[model samples]
Target: MTSTFPILTPAGVRRILLDRKEIALIDVREEDPFAQSHPLWAANFPLSKLELDAWPRIPRRDTPVVVYGEHDGVDLAPRAAQVLRALGYTSVHLLEGGLAGWIAAGGETFRDVNVASKSFGELVESKRHTPSLSAQEVQVLLDAHADAVVVDARRFDEYQTMSIPTATNVPGAELVLRVRELAPDPATRVIVNCAGRTRSIIGAQSLVNAGLPNPVAALRNGTIGWTLAGQKLDRGASRRAPADVTAINRARAQSGARDIAAKAGVRRIAYAELASLDAPGRTVYRFDVRTPDEFAAGHFPGFVSAPGGQLVQETDHNAPVRGARIVLADDDGVRADMSASWLAQMGWEVWVVDPVDAGLRSETGTVGHPAPEAEAVATITPGTLAGWLNDPKENDVAVLDVTASANYVKRHIPGAWFVIRAQLQQALEKIPSARRYVLTCGTSQLARFAAADLKRLTQAEVAVLEGGTQAWIEAKLPLEEGETRLAVPRSDRYRRPYEGTDNATEAMQAYLDWEFGLIAQLERDGTHFFNVV
Candidate 1:
């Protein structure tokens, strides 16, 4: 097929990065394959999720976008570019020769997701020489009942999965704010850990940067290290920082975090300054560095809820435009400044919305990306669809679920075939042809987009389920478990070696070794504008 998009060479991309111009280097493949190898700054969009994620992740329609995907004899770049163009993206281009072309040009490639963020963590440790205690040493403190406190810096769910014994779940951004309360005595030893190296290093460094009076150190290599030392981890742990923040502790935290943020050159901006960042040729990302529940209750109208810990751990996914301006917001004085401080050191022109006005938080509930305007497809209610499926005459209608493969396996409408939106056309060959087809997803948002693609492939009457599978379940309809019917291979999520307890000891050690060497990789890449403070 003749290519509709122009080609962008590796040299061209290097120039853009060096010049600090905004560009979205997107890898349009499944996350599992994309995690194996790609450019350091490239974000995984996955062709299957283009419509669902494009508008939110790559906000600007005209932002320079270079896409590439070639794995297992499948070339998805051209197809993805076509989809981008059709979605009104004006400046889409294909990478010259894809990943191989970049390699031939001496461009660096990195393994695993969020390579940029992980590399920066290593850079921070190398420059600052962050303090640490070996897993064996920490275990001794626990066994002797010493006056030491262990805090898990990963997300609560991860801590719940497996954590150090008696460790409180105080995530990265919360370390500065909550640690003083957790370990009240200045003489108390404070230990921070995560599943792997990044969060542990960053979390421990955060306290040191904040000038915490207590002796602070990272659990060397985190839970992975503990397991390697033949130590058992605690499962289903629920220990967490207390909910209430006393006025005195809150004031101390605010003062310390602000000082650190200033040292790192993070700007404290008012709401009025946001408009200036909206100028052409610039991409600005506004995020609320608060917990998901807090955000769901009420949040700044335009800001997305990205908890501070995960935001720093997954910057490439959160803000793909490498040189983009980031504005963070938090009602509490500590989280935004603490998060912004790390972002500033990572070479982002970041700002914290100082004194975030409560009145501006008019929006409430979980906000999804604005639904794109598409040709209206016919809709079928859950009750009516169930009646039709029960009737032999109307059972000819094909039900297609376009939700994530992981979610589909957990629970889905009984007999609904799981399909990848990107593979909808090819998958049609496997699905039996029907007089009419009804598409559904978690909430029918992705399904609505898939309906347009399905229309192009077949003349069959196409419709979307009203409210999708969730509605079916709410209507007291029976749901099926497991992958009962599959139109495409289940390869959406990449399993990380550092997550869970079943990983091989060698794989975990290799992962740590890879991270230990990222500082050298960063130097060779020469495009990362990191300036560790």
Candidate 2:
């Protein structure tokens, strides 16, 4: 049966991209499968967590949203469309014939997470000719204990996970701000690395753009290249950049950041001008480029926490609104100014707000917008659901665990059917008859999205389990293991060959080859307006 939502051909979507129209090309498949192949502009909008992620990812409900799935019998695009319509999305359509149609229409597809930004990073390096030192050369420098410091541009946890010997956790945004403290002497060399190529390249180029006195270079290919070359990585290392940034260093960072930002054409907006950016119907993302700890200590109200380095590395994950205006804020002006430089080069209309006003709030803790309200649905407590399971009167009560198949196989309520939330209606036909159905997931947030769908499909008394599987575990409940009761296969999360040390050498090499080929793909697509100073 054809969907009432019009079918958008791949050529039509391609034209939209070429014409630079605002579009949300959404792929409703799980991340892993979607990573294997997708249009360059398509963002993953998995069916399972549509309610939670869609509002922020696709801000304008009326934005042209073209959704696609595998086109197999189990495709989730149709179900996803229903959910989007329910969520009040005004304009929604499906990609005709799904991903296959895109390939058939000569649309370029990309692999790996954040492919767009990764390719752009490669372009930046190619254009600016970022400097780098290979693993062998870096090892020689480390052996000699030269006047050089290696800065891990990744998050602290990743540095803790694995790092080069004597590397400090400067993160990405901190590099430009704290480099003077780490390597005070102008002659000291600075080296930066991430798990892979992008952060290292960006970090090195940042200092070059800032006109820092020290010689800077990215550790070629980052940790992956090091491991491939048989260099030993230190695990559980916890060295951090110096805590107190000197006043002289602060002034230097600010001056340098301002100069670089000016060259990149980044903007600065005062609080009053920011008011217009906040008016309704405009898509503006405010980010505090400070560290999580700093933001928690005090930050402007309504700003999301996106530490500078990680924001540059994970632009797709943090800000999916490509054409949306972005405003970055920081107290010292160094962090936000430096970060805004990169974002501006990446084609974002970015602004840096000098955050010295009385409006800065000291609300200490994690900050985020309140989640959009979910539809009204009946729910049962974990303890109550347990009682219902044991009751003789309700012996026919059935459980549908809407978590990923991988999680289900790890631990699940005994006799619970592992299902994809959006596929609940189709799965119900094959499930055993029940007087009532209880839906659950890791936290039950996604279960709410499935509750109405289940009720509509089964017409049976459907209710979500409060607190989900986690709440059940807290109740000292027993769990079943194995892949015995599954309505959905585990295909959501991609297992990157480059991520862990356990992958076969061939697979890792293949991953590197794929990354190397992205430059050509970018040329073929030719839409990303990436510039490097």
Among these predicted structures, which one has the highest lDDT? 1
What is candidate 1's TM-score against the reference?
0.94
In model 2, which residue pairs have backbone atoms overlapping below 3 Å? Answer: 32-494, 173-309
Looking at candidate 1, what is the lDDT of residue 22? Answer: 89
| Residue-wise C-alpha lDDT for candidate 2, range 10-34, written one tens digit per residue | 8888777666566678888888888
In model 1, what is the error at residue 268, expressed in angstroms?
2.3
Best by TM-score: 1
The C-alpha RMSD in Å for every predicted model, in order, reads 2.1, 3.0
Off-target runs (Cα >4 Å) in candidate 2 are: 1-3, 6-9, 278-282, 362-364, 368-375, 387-399, 404-418, 425-436, 457-461, 473-487
Which tens-of-lDDT digit does each residue in 302-329 have in candidate 1? 8999999899999999998778899999
lDDT values for all models: 0.90, 0.83
